[model samples]
Target: MTCQRGWQLAVLMFFPLFLAACAQTPGKGGEVPSAPPPPTVDNAQSSGDEAACRLDDIQYAVGMPLGDPSSDALARQGGAEQVRVLRPGEAATMDHRPGRLNIHLDDNDVIEELRCG
Candidate 1:
């Protein structure tokens, strides 16, 4: 009988320790640990100042000869945040970058369109 009582007391004392060992420790500062946010797509073409991009500021690039150094100079002088010249039928991603002036040219290398994207 004494042996059984001793075993019961031993188990009773160790049970609380077992439960303590199984419990999770609190996070730093005693705050509950939260799940990390889900992954999101990263848009490489997005400009930080999209609202400030004004297409009308770079309209002078239209009708200019493409591949001409003078056109790039003009775009730089026209307050364009960024300049991208694309040739006709050229493969390009549709991603728009704000604060940028995209100059589209035809097969003849003539500037066909100028816009901010």
Candidate 2:
């Protein structure tokens, strides 16, 4: 009948529309939510204008913000090694041998001052 044809056409049209909508990510309550701000760290604690110092097997800097270890064996032995500027995905080693004024993430995990000779 005429009514059946109209219903079928409506269903066909609405199905495609519904699929298209489902493909997209819906916002909170059908509304786009505001993005949260990035977490920040205190820069004061980091090595401020400190020179990168490499000593013996240990390496570190004068002002590199260091993650205070919770009383570990290394601390008990004598003192843990120092921290120095390093590549984003690399460790502070002789091989890496970061040069002066190397852009690196600070001890606090935020990009800050670089190391210098």
Candidate 3:
């Protein structure tokens, strides 16, 4: 019928426009959104002395259990402004900070490595 043919023709004409509207053009809605900036270290939590963190001083804590009462004391011994305790398979930021002490723990909750980040 003529009505059927007209409906088909209208669909054919508008389908491309619908698809074009969905298409993203660069600098319009097509541009990839920028990634958020990396987090900034909180100065209030830092000792403000970058040179205070000494990895060698806390090397002895490598084999110690994280839950031990002395663990906190040991971390402070390194004079780091911030202490980050990382467990096995834990995710941590890669940002480097001279005053940050990173304590890498094993699966058994034991300190595996002590380093300055």
Candidate 4:
């Protein structure tokens, strides 16, 4: 029938236009857009004398059990203004702080490593 032919012709004509509309246009100068840059560590706290945490002084705390008294002493020894204890499978912020001490503990709650953030 003519009506059926008209519908088929209309679909054939519009299908290419629909596909062209969905096609991604090249960016400026015909170059594809690049992915965003990876995040960089914030250095605002590590500038000059602002870094008060010293990991070398608190390395002895590694392999020890993290108790309340020991945690306070370790923070003092490391000259850290803040202390963060991270246990296995625990979520922690990625932000780095030069004056903060990060204590990583194993599944047994024993200190595995000590580092200055």
Ranking the candidates on TM-score from highest down gives: 4, 3, 1, 2
Best by TM-score: 4
- C-alpha lDDT score of every prediction, in listed order: 0.72, 0.45, 0.78, 0.85
State the lDDT at 23 in candidate 2: 85
Ranked by lDDT, the better of candidates 1 and 3 is 3
Model 3 scores a TM of 0.55
Q: Higher TM-score: candidate 1 or 3? A: 3
lDDT of 2 by residue, 1-117 (tens): 999999999999899888987786769789866779999966563444433432222223324443432212212232333334454667554433222333355446543443333
Global lDDT for candidate 1?
0.72
Instruction: Output the better candidate (3/4) by lDDT.
Output: 4
Model 1, clash count?
A: 1
For lDDT, candidate 1 versus 4, the one ahead is 4
Regions more than 4 Å wrong, model 1: 1-47, 67-71
Residue-level lDDT of model 3, residues 1-117, one tens digit each, is 999999999999999999999985666567865769999867764466476588777677678788772656765788777888888777899988887788888888888888887
Q: For candidate 4, what is the total of clashing residue pairs?
A: 0
Question: For model 3, how big is the CA root-mean-square deviation?
Answer: 6.6
Error of 4 at 100 (Å): 1.8
- Model 1 weakest 10-residue run by lDDT: 44-53
In model 2, how large is the Cα lDDT of residue 81? Answer: 33
